[model samples]
Target: MNMIDPWGSSIIDYDKLTEQFGIKPFTDVVDDIPHASKLMTRGIIFGQRDYNKITDALNNNKPFATMTGMMPSGKMHIGHKMVVDQLKWYQEKNADIYVSIADMEAYAARGISKEKSRELALNEYITNYIALGLDVTRDNFHLYLQSENDDVKNLAYIIGKKVTFNQMRSIYGFNNSTNIAHIYTPLLQVADILHPQLKKYGGPKPVIVPVGPDQDPHIRLTRDLASKFNEEYGFIEPSATFHRFMTGLTGEKMSSSKPKSAIYLTDSLKDAVKKVKSAKTGGRESLKEQKELGGMPDKCSIYELLVYHLIDDDKKLEEIRSKCLSGEILCGNCKGCASELITDMFEELDQKREEARKIANTLLK
Candidate 1:
C-alpha cells in the first residue's frame, strides 16, 4: 500500500483512502467518483488550494509560467513520463514552460561523481524530454541546467534572506538534530520556483507544476516562501498541481533503483516482461479461494500500473477488474498481459528516444 508523508496534510493515503469510497483497488478510482475530476483533477493542488482565489488570476491571463525538472540520477522511467505528460498539458493550456535539468540538486542529494554525473544527467534528460515531445523553438520553451544559470543563484540568495533558520526547520522538520545543509537545501528548490522570470515575466503569474506527491515538501516550501515574498515585495504568483502518487509493481512508491517497482523507458522487452510477471499481487493463492473471496484490485500493484499508466480506456479497465475479482482471469496471466502491453509501449518510446537525442544535442549546444 502507498503511504502518505505525515507532514504533508494535503496528501491522501491513496491505497488506504480509496477503500472508504467503495472504490475497489485495481479499478479506476478516478472514474468511479463523478465530481472527482474537479476535486481530484491533475492540476488541483493537493493541499491548501484556494481555487476561487486562483481562478481569477488564471482568467485574467496575467503573464504566467509553468516549471518542472528532473534530476539525472539514473535512466528516465515511465514515472518520469507521468510528469512530462502533465507538463505538456499545461503547455497546451498556454503556460510558458521552463524545464530544468537539475544537476546541482542531484549532486546535493546523491553525492555522485559531480562532474561526470552532471554531464550524464544533462544529456539523458535533454534527450528524453525532447523525445517526449517538447519543442524548444516552436513552443518557446526554456531548457537549461540549474547550476549553469546565474539567475537561479541570485534568486536563491534573495529568497534565503527572507527565510529564517527557525522557519526552515519548521517547514522541513529539521531541528537541532538535523544537519545544517539539509535545512538550507530546500531553499534552492524554493528559488527554482521564483527566480529567472522576474525581469522577463515581470509579475505574479500562475505556475502549475506536475510532480509526484513525495516532492510535496518542495512545493509546500516554495509556496510558503512565495507568499512571504509576495506580501513583502509584491512579486510573482505561485501555484502548482500535485499529481497523485503512483506506486511501482511491488506496491510501493515507484523508485528507479528497484527495477521491479518501475518500468524504465529504456528497458528492453525481456526485462519488462520479467519484472511485471514477477510483481507482487493482492489476489488469492488458489482459484477456489479467489472464487469465494474477491481479489483486492485496489492493492494489486500490477493492476494499478495497467489502470493509471497503460490502459487508456475506462470500459476495458473495469472489465479487467471484474474479471480479476471474479476469478475469471488468473494473476499470472493478468500480469503477463500487462507486461506485454507495457513492453510494446516502451518499444515505441525507445524509437522516439533516438529521434529526441538528435534534437536535444542541437538545443543543448
Candidate 2:
C-alpha cells in the first residue's frame, strides 16, 4: 500500500510494497553482496530488484557502476543524506559512481529556473554529497546535469522510442493533468539509469541505483526497457535498493517546502536543535503515563532519526529502543540527546561542505 510518485514524496509502507510489488527482500541477497551496509542489515534498505548482478560483478572482479540522480529544488536534507550515504558505500567498493543533477525535472515539476536549479545542484546538493563522504576524485566518478549531458539526451531519445504513452500512464499514474515534459522526463530518467552501460561509459555492465522507494517506478520502467532494448538485453537492467522515507517533524511527510518538517543539512546549529526538540513522538500524553504504559518507539519520529540518520551502531540503537519501550527514556530527554547528536553531525558536515565548495568546479560538468 505504498503510494509512490517520482514527482512527489510520500511516507511508504515498506513491507506492503514488498509483498504487493514482488520486490525481493534485501535479506534474500544479503549474504551474497559482501560488506553489506548497515542500511541493508537493519532493513533501511528493505527491497531490491536484480541486486544479484552487483554481487556477481563483485565476486567475479568485474566492473559495476552505481548512479543516483538528484532534483535540485531545495536544500539537501536528512532524507537526501540517506542516498549519499549509500553512494559512499558503493564508492568504497570501487563501483564507478555517476551522480546526475535532474535540472530538467526541477524545471518541469517545480517551474524552477535552470540557473537556480544549477546553483542549487552544485552549491547545495553536491556539496553535501562530498561532505557526507562521496568519493569525487576517482577517475571513473562523474557528475553531470541532464541538460548538459548529450549522451544521456541522446540515449533518452533512443529509449523513448521503446516506450509508449500508455505505458507511462500506467506506471506513473499520469493523465490529462500531467505536463508533456513531465511525461517525457521518465524517458530521460530511464536513459540516466541505462546510459552507464553504453559503450562509452563502460559497455553493458551492471549498475546499482540506491534510492527511496518513491523512485522505483523509474527503475521498473528502466528495467523493462533494458530487457527490450536488444536481442541479448544489451543493457543490463539497473538494479535498485529501496529505503524508507523520513517523516516530518510533525509526523507529516518530510518536505523541502515545509521547512519545519525536515532538518536541512544547511540548517544552522541552533535551528537544527530546535527542529529536533519540536519533532513528533509516539509517547504517551504525559511522562507519568509514559512510565505506566511504556513508549511507542515504532511510531516516533525521534526513533526514526536514530534508525535512518543520527545513530550508527546497532547495539547503541537497540539500547535506545529498549529504554523507550521500557519507559526509562522520556520524550523531553530523548529530544535533548537527539539534538546534541544532530548538532555535532551538522557542525562537522558544515565544515566539510566548506571544503567541498572548493572543489565544486572540479566535480560539476
Candidate 3:
C-alpha cells in the first residue's frame, strides 16, 4: 500500500515512494534551480512537489521562506545533517528561514516531557545546527518551540476543525487505541508549516520544506489545508523537496534510537571513526572475488557517507564511485578515507560546539 509512518523507524523504497505518491522527479526541474546544492544536483534529493514555485522565487528575486522542524526525541545523528545542509543552502540564497522545535509533537509521539525536549533541542540539535553553519542568529531566521508558539497552537486548533478523526486515521494509520494527543499532533505540524505564511510573519510567500520521503503525509495534508484556507488567510501552499535517507552502518536506515545504526553528532571522534570502520561495505567475499567482481558502491554505507557529507567535489566523488565499480578500490581503503574525512570533520565540530552551545542556549528564550 506504500504507507509511510513518519514516527516509525522503517526503510523506504525511494522508487516506490515516487511512483505511488505522485511526487514529481526532482531531476525534472533541477536545472531550473540556480546554483543548485549537491543534494539536488546529485540524486540524493530525488523528488519534489511544486518545487517550481521555489525556483521561480529564487530566479525572480521574490521573497520565499524555508521551514523545517526537529522533533527533539533523541540525539541528532549524521542523517539529520542533510536538513541542516539544506537550511544553509537556503540561507545563502537569501530565503527567510524558520526552524520549529517540534516539542509538542515529541511529547505526544515519543512520551518525552516538554522540559526534556527543550534541553535536547538546545544542547544537541540546535547546537549542531549552528556548528554546521546555519546562521540562526540572522534577522530572517526564526526559531521557536511549538509548545510556546501561541500563533502555531491557535492556528492548529482553528484549522484542525476542517479535518476529522477519519482523515487522521487514514493518513497516519491511527486506530481507536491511538491517543488524542497523537491524533492532534499532525495538525500542529500542519500549522508549523503554514504559519510562516501568516500576515504577522509576512503574508503569503512561497515556503519550502525539505524533508525525507516518509514525511510526505504531512506535506500532502499541509498543502490541502493551505488550499482550503487560501481565501481567509491568503495562504500559498508550501513547496517540498524529498531527499533519500542515509543508510545505517549496518545497512539499515540510520536512526537516532538505534545507536549502532547511527553516528551521533555528539559521538566522540574515536567512536565515530570506529563506527565508520565497522560499517557495512560493498566489497565481495574475498580479495580474489572483489578484484574480479568489483565493489558495489550503490550498496555501501561508506559510499553514502562520502556522497552525503564527506565528499563534496562531484568529480572526485565520481572517481571514487568509478573505482569502486571497476574493482580498482577496495572496502578497507574506502573505510580509511572515510575515517580520515570524518576525523577532520568531527575535530572541527568539537572545536566549535562549545560556542555553538552558548549560542543555542541564548536562542528560543
Which model scores highest in TM-score? Answer: 3
Kindly report the root-mean-square deviation of model 2 from the true structure over all alpha carbons: 1.6
Clash pairs (backbone) in predicted model 3: none
TM-score computed on alpha carbons, candidate 1:
0.81
Assess each prediction's global lDDT (C-alpha) against the native: 0.65, 0.86, 0.94
Arrange candidates by lDDT, descending.
Answer: 3, 2, 1
**lDDT per residue, candidate 2, 224-267, as tens digits?**
88999956438877899888788788898888888989998889
Worst 10 residues of 3 by lDDT: 1-10
lDDT of 1 by residue, 151-207 (tens): 776788788887888766555566687555445567766777776446555555566
Task: Tell me how candidate 1 scores on lDDT.
Answer: 0.65
Q: What is the lDDT of residue 80 in candidate 3?
A: 97
Task: Supply the TM-score for candidate 2.
Answer: 0.96
**Candidate 3: tens digits of C-alpha lDDT, residues 1-365:** 55789998788988888889899999999999999999999889999999989999999999999999989988999999999999999999999999999989988998999999999999999999999998988999999999999999999999998998988888999999999999999999999999999889989999999999999999999999999999999999999999999999999999888999999999999999999999999889999888888999999999999999999899999999999998999999999999999999999999999999999999976
